[model samples]
Target: MTMFLTIAVIVLIFVVIFQIAKASEYVSVLKGEEVSRKQNNKINGFLMIVFLVLGLIGVWYCNKLYYGKTLLPHGSASVEGERVDSMLWVTLAVTGIVFVLTQIILFWFAYKYQETEKRKVFFFPHSNTLELIWTIIPAVTLTVLVIIGLRNWFLFTGEPPQNAAVVEVTGKQFGWIFRYPGKDGAFGKKYFRNIDPANNVLGLIWEDELSHDDIVTEQTLYLVKGRPVKLIIGSRDVIHDVGLSHFRLKMDAVPGIPTTMWFTPKYTTKEMKEITGNPNFVYEISCDQMCGNGHYSMKGVIEVVEQAEYDLYMAKQKPNYLDVFPDKDPAAAKADTTKTVAAKTADTAAKAAAKL
Candidate 1:
């Protein structure tokens, strides 16, 4: 019954469209003969003026209505982000001026030169001077913009500071994993065959001494305010992207390949909330790529705190799995050996009694 209703609605729509077309044809047949040259000129001129006014008003209000809400948040949260924002504003200003000026000229020409019986139309086809002026101006403008863009790109992508905090962001089917280098400030090697879904999701090689000190978490990336952070990003299953919108940082997390992005957080989470006048505001890390069915749920929070707070948070995290098991420490190893010997002796006695 539902499918039949749907088909009926579609057919009815086509019938209505056909009737509208027939009505338009009849209207054209009657009015087309009544349009005079003077009437055409007057109508075209009026429409040109109306369009010019409406277009400018629309452009003005569009920016006023959506600038802060959708174009960009009022300000940037990082030093590089500020630079990026500035470049964007510069580009917008340049293009906006050209757009408004060209639009006004086009409409003015249409209104001024609308078909009129008394006016003689100018027949000159082209001017080398005018052509050269237009061509040179755009070429020069583009060259300047490109130069500025490349300079800023290099500045932002240059080598990170020595004190930059290193974090590894791993992307998988529908979530992100954050790994922080522990006391040694180095990441352990990873092996694909060693990937344990429950314990070692990153396939970190447990035998590597560095793996013992690595801190891994599935949620809440923690950072220190006013410190540079270097992110090493990778993907396990498919391509994903790490987008830190507030910081204006983005990089692809490609499968079987590693990528990196770096930025400094100028505002702590608390400070940003106060700045934005929203108490619940927090920095977010989102997947910008469409990787799978659950891609929309692939998001994480970034908590920026003071340096002391960051240090305290790191100190409380548990060590890697290998450190707590297998008794790697000498004292713990001896105790484990003793326990094993006692258990073996007890098992032997129990077996002999059962045989008797």
Candidate 2:
């Protein structure tokens, strides 16, 4: 019913417009074409100035209204992200100046040069000097912007610092998988065919001892504040993007191809919550690209903490390997051995009492 009403209203609007147009045509015929054209031109020139004023107001109003809601208010969560923020500001400034100047000139010229009986139209055929100025200025400005962007890009994707911690990120149908290299600081080999939904989420080769301690997790990725983190990203099924808007960095997670980027986190989740004045605030990871139907649901969280807190968290995490092969877990084996020894001692003591 709502849709029908909307359609009816739209149809009524068209009919009204048509009638107004026909009435205008009759009036134009009565007033003569030359006089009507001049009047319409005057109206359009006045409307242009009004539009320019309103548009400028709207731009300012929108920025004022939504600026606080945007990530820009709190600044970046990563040190490297500060550069991204800087670049963005520079780009916006350059483009914004150009936009305002162009708009002002365009509308002001239309209003000032409106058709007048006392004045004649100046035929601006071509000015090579003007053309060169416009072309060269934009080209030079764009080239400089591109160079700055490229330099930042290279630094982001380049080799991380020696002390940087590395983590593997894998994207699947509607979720993210994170892996932390155990004490060995290496990741095990993985085969696509070995992917098991139940136990082996990352398809790590058990034969590869290096993989035995690689920690695998799904919902939350952990990092240390003030420490650089290097991410090795990939996809299991289709293309996905790892968007860290808070950190102001993103990288593509392509199937069969691993991409990498690094950044040093400046604040922890606890710190951000305080900074933003939102007690429930958490750093979020969003899939920037449309992967599939569940792409909207594909989200991950990052928990940044101090080194000691991170160490404690890591200590509590049992590797995916141990989960798959519990018998091989030294902790489990030790417990089993202790239980067997206790049972044996109890049985021996009982036997001695029975003999007595």
Candidate 3:
């Protein structure tokens, strides 16, 4: 209701303004002072110049304000980030130069060619030289830009090194799941039907021996600095983008299809914090696509540490449940169950005796 009322008020305001303009024109006709087309053109030309200067100033001030606030974060932290930044600057410079030149010429022509009684207009229907100049210039510029862009793209998407660290990232409705290949250096096979919401969210086939040693985490991703890391990304539900802003990396996480990205972190978390001068600074992985209502909350943290530190961190993580229980051996599974039951029984019995 409030929206409807606001829209109605705006419509009424426009109607009132239109009526006032018509009435003013009627009053001018009554005064017998004819409207002069040349005078109107001159006024419009002057206003165009004023608007052009003001617009340029406004753009400059806005840019200054944005940079002053430090709204844009620093450059990338990955080895390939410098090349990406260079390409971006090149594109921006080309576009910026064209934008400024076109705007200047546009407003200057408007002011110079304003209608006047004493000045006669000359019309040139066509100029082949002018046409060729505009076309060839843009064509050459675009070709050069495209070549640079394609080269960068190929470099960015090159195959990962053989010694690269392998990590799997999965996106869902409102969260991310990361899995690391444990001691086996192999990711186990996964099946959609085997997915258990509580126990095995990633649906690893417990029967496969390779699945036993995978380490899974919900919101934290760990990496080794100076080591090439290959990320295999997928989504369980809708499409999502795995965005690592600091690395200048983004790839779509599509359901039923896996995508890969590779990068090497040049800076560790501690070093980056000191460089940024923000004690709480940490690298983050965020979902760039607007997938659903809870999309805004889909975020994760990345910790880049030394290789030794990463080894220590991995050593403390518990293996998957299936690793502790071999499905092929019923006796061993039973023995484990018996031990748990016996421990619980003893605890209960002790509690009863204490009450007595």
Task: Name the candidate, 2 or 3, with the larger lDDT value.
Answer: 2
Candidate 2 — number of clashing residue pairs?
Answer: 0
Clashes in model 2: which pairs?
none
Q: What lDDT does each candidate get?
A: 0.86, 0.96, 0.87
What tens digits encode model 1's per-residue C-alpha lDDT throughout 1-356?
99999999999999999998687667657778356445656877989989999989998898798876752764778877887788888999999899989999999999988876688988999999999999999999989989988887776667789989899999988888999987888888989888788888888887888888798888699999999988899998899999888987788999888888788889999998988888999899899999989999999999999999999999877655544454665556788889999999999999999999
Candidate 3 per-residue lDDT over residues 1-356, each given as its tens digit: 99999999999999999998787677667665455445556778999899899999998999887974451366779987777777778888999999999998999899988876678989899999999999999999999989987886776667888899999999988999999997889999999887777888888887877887888888999999999999999987899999988898888999889998899899999999988888999899999999999999999999999999999999877666544455744556799999999999999999999999
lDDT of 1: 0.86
Candidate 2 per-residue lDDT, tens place, 34-137, comes to 88889889999999999999999999999999999999999999999999999999999999999999999999999999889999877889999999999999
| Consecutive 10-residue window with the lowest summed lDDT within model 1 | 322-331
RMSD values, in order shown: 6.4, 1.4, 5.5
Candidate scoring better on TM-score of 1 and 2: 2
The candidate that achieves the highest lDDT relative to the unseen native structure? 2
Q: Judge candidate 2 against the unseen true structure and give its global Cα lDDT, from 0 to 1.
A: 0.96
